[model samples]
Target: MAQKYKYARPGVETTPWNSLDVRVTDPFGNRITFTQRLPE
Candidate 1:
């Protein structure tokens, strides 16, 4: 019996991260926010 294996795929659609936002609270009752923006 022969074994089948998958190789690296070609012509994969690539997309960029547009933006992101995150918020967090610390133990000292503090608020934190992180924002990121990417170019098209």
Candidate 2:
């Protein structure tokens, strides 16, 4: 799933590009956040 998301672009209805936020919850009830920048 992460591989697919890496190449995905923001949809037309979404906000302007600056950064992307990704959140994931593990089975152990731990929450993780990821911040990514758009490619040049």
Candidate 3:
């Protein structure tokens, strides 16, 4: 299935392995992808 959402207004913090999961439907239903780099 194509991803319908990406990114969220999380709490006060976020990590690469953590997800806020707040979803809103995209009218266009376009696929989106995001990458979070690990801390160096």
Candidate 4:
């Protein structure tokens, strides 16, 4: 999935990790991939 990061105010910067894909496993042993979009 494609991810995007946004800043709440002007002249703000976004981090590299904010636009990356993250993988996690659940208790049922299933792998899930999701985007990490964060606001600054």
- For all predictions, the C-alpha RMSD in Å is 14.4, 8.2, 9.9, 13.2
lDDT, each prediction:
0.51, 0.55, 0.42, 0.53
What is the TM-score of each predicted model, taking all chains together? 0.44, 0.44, 0.26, 0.37
Residues 1-40 of candidate 4 have per-residue lDDT tens digits of: 9554332112333458665565556656676666657865
- Backbone clashes for every candidate come to 0, 0, 0, 0
Task: Point out where model 1 deviates above 4 Å.
Answer: 1-18
Model 4 off-target regions past 4 Å? Answer: 1-19, 36-40
Candidate 2 C-alpha lDDT tens digits along 1-40: 3454433333322226766777666656676666777675
Q: In model 1, what lDDT does residue 34 have? A: 66
Q: Which lDDT tens digits does candidate 1 get at residues 1-40?
A: 9553233222322335666656565656576666677566
Total clashes, candidate 3? 0
Arrange candidates by lDDT, highest first: which order? 2, 4, 1, 3
User: What is the TM-score of candidate 2?
Assistant: 0.44
What TM-score does prediction 3 earn?
0.26
Name every residue pair that clashes in candidate 3: none
